[model samples]
Target: MKTKDKIMIFFLTIITFGTIWIYWNSKKKNNKKNELSRSEKISFDINDLILFLGDINNIQNVENTHKKVKIYIKDSNLVKTEEIQKLKGISSTLVSSEYVNIIVGNVAEFLKEELSRKMEK
Candidate 1:
């Protein structure tokens, strides 16, 4: 093949691969960002709830009025039962698993209260 033709072909190949790489990387980044922004629904096992209440003490009026509890945590899925227990254990009133309903505006609070109530039993 002529030198000019070969050079043209090489450049075209490079451009095509570069475009594909950039597109792929951008798409991957967008997906990661979306995942970070999305909210997560977390379900806690009964045992984990008990451990959480042992840690937190400030939580008051913890009552279990629902058979099942579900909460939405925005932008995070990591929940430590130990940390929740620490916060609820500090509450002035003893948590009860029978009739207490701790309501919060955010997912973290909801989980904290629910776990605290479960532990109270």
Candidate 2:
């Protein structure tokens, strides 16, 4: 090939490789950052209901009634109460074999969306 054509091809090849290297390294760095950062805990109270969630704590609630405070472990899949009760904040769980109902009032709508976003990451 002519010297000018050869030089142009070399520059193009270098540019392509450099771009690929930069893209791959950027993606790896972003993934590493996500792995290193922990999920943030969120808390909010409306009326007599309380909500709390963390890495160790999936999703839970403490409902205050006239005379009793009840705990509920909420999840999309059925989980043993014994395993859930073992976690802090879940004093006594009814132990459900059914997946949590999204329509249920235990989890507020906005918080559920936020949790879903976090889990996606």
Top candidate when judged by lDDT against the true structure: 1
**Model 2 score (lDDT):** 0.43
* Residue lDDT tens for model 1, 66-108: 2223332221223343354444322222223432232322343
Q: In angstroms, what RMSD does candidate 1 have relative to the true structure? A: 12.0
Give the whole-model CA lDDT for all candidates, comma-separated. 0.44, 0.43
For each candidate in turn, the TM-score is: 0.32, 0.29
1-121, model 2: which lDDT tens digit per residue? 8999999999999999999999999988877644222222323332112222224144454433322233345553434434434443233444343322222222334434454444455
Residue 108 lDDT in candidate 2: 35
Question: Which residue segments of model 1 deviate by more than 4 Å?
Answer: 32-110, 113-121
